[model samples]
Target: MQDAGFVWNAEELDAFIESPRKHVRGTNMSYPGERRPEKRAAIIEYLTQLSTAD
Candidate 1:
């Protein structure tokens, strides 16, 4: 979201994953969110791994 000045770092990613709409108002993301903290953490971890894979 360059227009919104949103950065995609881990901490921002965590909050955005928790609630897309709340984190970035007017977001088109339809998925509600991962309500469980553990699950969210897992998702973020998996994503991080994917991004770093070589």
Candidate 2:
């Protein structure tokens, strides 16, 4: 989900990152483990890096 240096609106980015589980219900994805926090943090960090990269 990292934008890889692409620009996106702050609201859109926040929605994607803080979206509720129900919003993702139809997707074929699952985070069923204790590593969920770590994984999510990694994604956020990656996206942040991409957003901040010049």
> Against the true structure, whose lDDT is highest?
1
> What lDDT score belongs to each candidate, Candidate 1 first?
0.84, 0.50
Which tens-of-lDDT digit does each residue in 1-54 have in candidate 2?
A: 342334555434443455533334444436432235555566677888998999
Q: How close to the true structure is residue 33 of candidate 2, measured as C-alpha lDDT? A: 26
Alpha-carbon shift of residue 21 in model 1 (angstroms): 0.3
Model 1 CA deviation exceeding 4 Å by range: none
Candidate 1 lDDT by residue in tens digits, 1-54? 556576788888888888988988888999898778888889889999999999
| Best of the candidates, TM-score | 1
lDDT of 2: 0.50
